[model samples]
Target: MTDLLPLWRDLLLGGFILLAYTTEAMTGFGSIVIALSLGALILPIDDVQTVLVPLNICMTGFLSWRHRNHIDWRLLGRLIMPFMLAGTVLGYWVQPVLGGALLKVGFALLVLWFVLRELRRAARGHVAAPKSGWWSRGIVLGAGVTHGLFASGGPLLVYGLAGLSLDKARFRATLILVWFSLNSLLTLLYLNQGRLQPLAPHVLAYLPLIPLGIVLGERLHHRVDEVTFRLWIYRVLAVSASALLLASLLQLG
Candidate 1:
C-alpha cells in the first residue's frame, strides 16, 4: 500500500503534466504556464521549479526533435534565442533575491496579462496578433528571463505568438523548437548550480509516459479544426490565469 501510494502520487502529478503537454502539442503553448502554476497545487514552490526544470528539458527537447522537420529556424534564432539567454541570466540574479510576496505578485501579474490578452484577442474578432518590434522584443526577452526564474513563462512567450494566427501545427512545432533551446539552457544552468537534484530521479520514473502522451496528443491535435482548438486554448488560458491569480493572492494574503 505504501509503495502503491507513492506511485499513485507520481502518476497524479504526471497526469497533470500530461494534460498540460496535450494542450501544448495540440495548440502549442499553455502547458508550461498552466503547468507551472498548477504544479504549485501538487508540489512545493521551490520543488515545483526543480521538478519542472528537468521535465521541461525532456519534453521540450523531445517534442522539438520529434517535430523539428516543421520548425522555423529563422523564427527561433531571431526571436527566442537572445531573449532566453538574457532572461536566464536575469532570473539567476533575481529569483532568490525577491521577497516571496512580491514575487507572488509578479507571478500573478503575468498570469493576469496572459488571461486578459487572450480574452481581448478573442473579443477583437480573433484577428491575428500585431507584429512585434522593439518593445515586443524586450517583452519576449523579459518573458524569457521570467521563464528561467519561474516556469510559468509560457504566457509571455506563447500567448504572444497567438497574434500571428498560426495554425495549430505550426504553433506547436515552433513553440517546441523555441522551448527546446530555452528550457535546455535553463536546465543546464540549474544543473550547474546543483538545483537538478531530486528532479532526475523523479523524471526518470516518469519519463516513460511522455512519449505515450505525445503520440496520443498529436493524433487528436491533427483531428481538430483551427477555430475549435483555439477556443479551447483560450478557455484553458482563462482558467489557468484565474487559478494563478487566486493562488497568488491566497499565498500573499
Candidate 2:
C-alpha cells in the first residue's frame, strides 16, 4: 500500500501537469496558476510552484521559438516587460512582510471584478475600450507582483493584454514570450537561493508532460474562432479567480 501510494501521487501530479500546461499552450498563459490551484490539493503549494516554475520555461521557450514572428515585440518591450519586471522586484521584496492570505484574497477579488466586467461587455456585444494611460500599466505591474509572489500572474496579465485587441496567434505567442522572460528571471533567483537543487529530481520526473501538453493545446487552439478565443480567456480568469478566492477563504477559516 505504501509503494502504491507514491505511484498514485505521481500519476495525479502528471495529470495535473498535463491539464494545466495544455491550458497555457492554448491560451499562452494559465499553466502555473491552474497547476498550482489544482496541484495544491495533492501537494504542498511551495513544492508545486518549485516544480512548475522551472518546467514552465521549457513549455514557453518552445512556443516562443516556434511563433517568434507573431510576437508583438514593440508592445512587449515598451510596455509590458518593464512594468512587470519592476513590480516583480517589489513583490519579491515585500512578500515576507505581506501575508499570503491577504494578498491572495485581494488579488482574487480584483481579478473577478475585471473578468466579470469584460464578460458582461462581450455578452452585450459591446466593444471594450482599448486599455491605455496608467490604468493598463498599473494592471501589468500588479501582474508582476503576483508573478513574483505566486508565479501565477497570468490572470492579471491576460486582463491587461485583452485591451490591446491582439489576434489569437499574436496573443498566444507574445504572452509565451513574456512568461519565458519572467520565468527565466525567477529560475535564476531560485538557483541563487539554492531552492531548486532539492527539487531537481521532481522537475525531471515531470518534464515529459510539457511537450505532450503543448501538442494537445496546439490542436485545440486552432479550432476556436477569435471571438470564442477571447471569451475563453475571460472564462479562464473567472474560474482561476474564483478558485483562488475559495482557497484563501478556506485558509482564513
Candidate 3:
C-alpha cells in the first residue's frame, strides 16, 4: 500500500473527495460512484476504495443525520436494506477472486446503461420521474453486490429509489440513511477482514476537507432545481462512465 501523504497525491485525492461528496450532499447519493471512477484514474483501485469507503461512511452518516426526520423508513426497511446486506456479505466473500480489469469494464457498462436509460426518460420529458411498481428483490441484492465489489452501487440503488416515487427531499433523505447503514456494514466486513486499518492514516489526513465539501454540496443542493439537477447528474454519470471505460481499455492495451 502506498502512503497517501506525498503532498501532490493528497491534493489530488482531496479534490476528488470534495467533488464526490459535494455531489452526494446535493443529490443524497453519488459520492462513491463518482469518487471511485475518478480516483482510480490516479490511484490504484484498491487504495482508492480503501480510503474512500470510510470517508463515504462518515459523509453519508452526517447527511443521514441532517435529514433524519424525512427518511422513508418503510421503503428502506422492507424493500432495500435486507437484500443489500446479504449481497454485501456475499460480495465481500467473492471479491478476492474477481479480476480488477473485468470488474472495471462491468462497472463502466452498468453506469452507461443507467445514463442512457435516464437520458431516454428525459427525452420523453420525464426527468426525475419515478416508475411505479418496479421494485424487486433482485435489484436490491444486485446493488449490494456491486457496492460490495466495486463501491459504486449508488447508481443501481438510485434508479431503484427513483422508481418508488418518493418526494425529492424524502428520497434524498432515505437514500442517505440507507447508504449510511449499508456502508457501515461494509466497513465492518472490511474491519473483520483486516482491510480498513491500513487506510486509517490517509483517512485521518483527509478529514479536514470533508466538512468543506459537505457545506458546499448542501448549498449546491438547495440552489439547483429538480429538473436541472437530474440533467447534470446524468451528464456526470456519462462522463465518469466514459472515463472509467477509457482507463480500463488503456490498461488492457
Best by TM-score: 2
RMSD of 3: 2.9
What root-mean-square deviation over C-alphas does model 1 reach? 2.7
User: With candidate 3 superimposed using the best TM-score fit, by how many Å does residue 65's alpha carbon deviate from the native?
Assistant: 1.2
Rank ordering of all candidates by TM-score, starting from the highest: 2, 3, 1
Worst 10 residues of 1 by lDDT: 158-167
Distance from true location, Cα of 27 in model 3, Å: 0.5
TM-score of candidate 3 against the unseen true structure: 0.90
Estimate the overall C-alpha local distance difference test score of candidate 2: 0.86
How many clashes (backbone N, Cα, C below 3 Å) per candidate?
2, 0, 0
Tell me the TM-score of each prediction against the true structure: 0.86, 0.95, 0.90
Best by lDDT: 2
List, residue by residue over 56-140, the lDDT tens digit for candidate 1. Answer: 6677787888877788777677876777668767876787786265676676666677667767777787676555677667777
> 2 or 3, which is superior by TM-score?
2
In candidate 2, what are the lDDT values of residues 1-253, reduced to their tens digit?
Answer: 8889879988998997898899889989988887777676667767788889999999999999999999999999988999999988887778778737777889889989988898888989988777876888998998899998888778888877765768999989998999999999988988888889999999999999999999999998999899998888888777777877777777677
In candidate 3, which residue pairs get closer than 3 Å at backbone N, Cα or C atoms, i.e. clash?
A: none
Error of 1 at 135 (Å): 1.9
lDDT, ranked from best to worst: 2, 3, 1
